[model samples]
Target: MDIEFLKTSILEFVQNHKSYAPFVLGLMTFAESLAFVSLLLPTMTILIAVGFVLAAADIPFWQAWAGAVCGAFLGNWLSYEIGQRYKKTAYELWPLSRNPKLIARGEAFFQRFGPWAVFLGRFFGPIRAVIALIAGIFLMPQVLFQAANLASASVWAFIILAPGAGLAHYVLW
Candidate 1:
């Protein structure tokens, strides 16, 4: 039940299973970025912590970082596709349906920022999860959506992992 305990357990798991760090980190980032799933998982904090664990465990930072980037890009891509396919009905899906305000905010943000919303949203916690959905709903071009998604996801992964990695390196060295 304790969040810290869960984080510690995950860190321990990653530490013990260094070979799986990239895959696990990828999954974590995927869940963290995915629409609806992002709301429930709240894995960002744990992910940063895993960065520290990965460094301390000497699990190859580049591998973990790359995995995170790939997972994040794929997650957002799926969300965008879902939005495109489902349109407004995506909001009718359980958790999203329950929180209409999130959909509204995502829509407003997409309207206000346009394609840039996808790039900027990656940095913002609340809007990050839904912006892709909004982009899908509004039918943003695939090329534009992917450009921002890839760039932002890479940067976001670095931002999340670097600090912890740096701290671990500093302490370990």
Candidate 2:
């Protein structure tokens, strides 16, 4: 389906079924953050529309925000684990394997920014997963990566979700 259609459908579901909103939010976040998958999923628009649905449907903002944060964190953690376990092999297999520049750019970004790339890359869709993978490949200290990951994920969750939430709140109120 097209972006407009998907956005409309997600908003409709969010408004009609309040109980499933959290799950939907989580799924979207996971797809948006997961390595490889993130490159394909056009979830950003749908997720923002979901925020508007939350306001229209009276779903609490915290619930949606929490779901997004949790899913994003887990998705990146899994990607990091993949990087740690497979090393360069992971990048050599499908998706990243097909796109060598993804790893190259991520490495360059990480080299220049160090741990800060973890936090900053969260905001850039094209490089988010790559940065996470690079961080793992470089054997960045776990504590540092986690700290940056958590912080970046929170900011990312809000940056992606808040505008719709705010618009919905104002329009609905």
Candidate 3:
């Protein structure tokens, strides 16, 4: 019921299960970036908190960062695949069907920026949810989509994780 409590619990768990830092952080970012899942779970805040937890737990930053990267890449890739498979009806999906503005914004962003939307969208919440899906629906080149996906995933993971990782040293220590 209490979101803060849930977040704190997760951070605590990550601190205690130092070995699972990568897995937990990976899963959190995966859910944070996934299409439908992203709409449901706001894991970004928890994810940032996790960075501090991992730092405090003494888990290697690269290991946890790699996990976050892989998770984000796979999550967006799955969404892109879904869009490719159901390009005609991606909008007909439940939550998306219920939310028209989200689609419109994604469409406009995709149209304006084209392939770069895939990369730029990662930093924006609304666009991030549907930009990759739109890219697939419009049949953007696979290589380009993947290139942006991987790069953005890597950068986005770093941006989200780095703050906590860096700040933990000064604040926690």
Candidate 4:
């Protein structure tokens, strides 16, 4: 199937099953935030579309936004733990192993920015996926990582979903 067809189908699914939109969005954001999985799954675009769909379909925005935040936080937290446990071995994993530049960039970003990278990287596309891992590999303090993670996840969810939702709300309501 074409991308357009997939988009249409997903929009239809969200519209038809309003209650499931938040859950599906949570899964999408989870994949979008996960380390290796983020590279493979292009959920960002779909998530923006879902935001519009949620507003157009009159699904509660807070529910979907909360789900996205939780999913993103959990995904990043898992990546951080993996990096802590696996260390440099994480860079040897498939997909990550294949993309040396991504690892290098993530490392540089984390190194240059320190703990702030965890919060700032959430706003950047490629960095968002691996910053948490880099932080873990470098042994950043757990409390600091989580503080940045939680704050950034919440803001990121709002930034990603708000535009489409607000636009739809303005046009539809």
lDDT of 4 at 97: 89
Candidate 2, residues 1-111, lDDT tens digits: the string is 698787577667767888877777888888888888888786878887767778777788888888889888887877787778778777876788788888888889999
The residue-by-residue lDDT of candidate 3 on 15-67, one tens digit each, is 67877767777888888878878988888888887778778767889999999
RMSD per model, one decimal: 3.3, 3.4, 3.4, 3.0
Any runs in candidate 3 off by more than 4 Å, and if so which?
1-16
What would you estimate as the lDDT of candidate 4?
Answer: 0.88
Among residues 3 or more apart in sequence or in different chains, the pairs in candidate 4 whose N, CA or C atoms overlap within 3 Å are none
For candidate 3, the per-residue lDDT at 116 reads: 90
Instruction: Please estimate how well model 2 matches the true structure, expressed as its whole-model Cα lDDT.
Output: 0.82
For candidate 1, the per-residue lDDT at 87 reads: 94
lDDT of 3 at 172: 69
Give one clash count per candidate, in the order shown. 0, 0, 0, 0
Angstrom error of the Cα, residue 64, model 1: value is 0.7
lDDT of 4 by residue, 25-95 (tens): 78888888889899888688778766788887778889999999989999999999999999999999988
Question: Can you tell me which runs of candidate 2 are displaced by over 4 Å?
Answer: 1-16, 171-173
Whole-model alpha-carbon lDDT for candidate 1: 0.88
Return the clash pairs for model 2, or none. Answer: none
Instruction: After superposing candidate 4 on the true structure, give the runs of residues whose Cα lies further than 4 Å from its correct spot.
Output: 1-16, 171-173
Q: How far in Å is the alpha carbon of 150 misplaced in model 2?
A: 0.8
lDDT of 1 by residue, 63-149 (tens): 999999989999999999999999999888988889888888888888999999999998888788899988998999999999999
Backbone clashes (count) for model 1: 0
lDDT per model, in order? 0.88, 0.82, 0.87, 0.88
TM-score of each: 0.90, 0.88, 0.90, 0.90
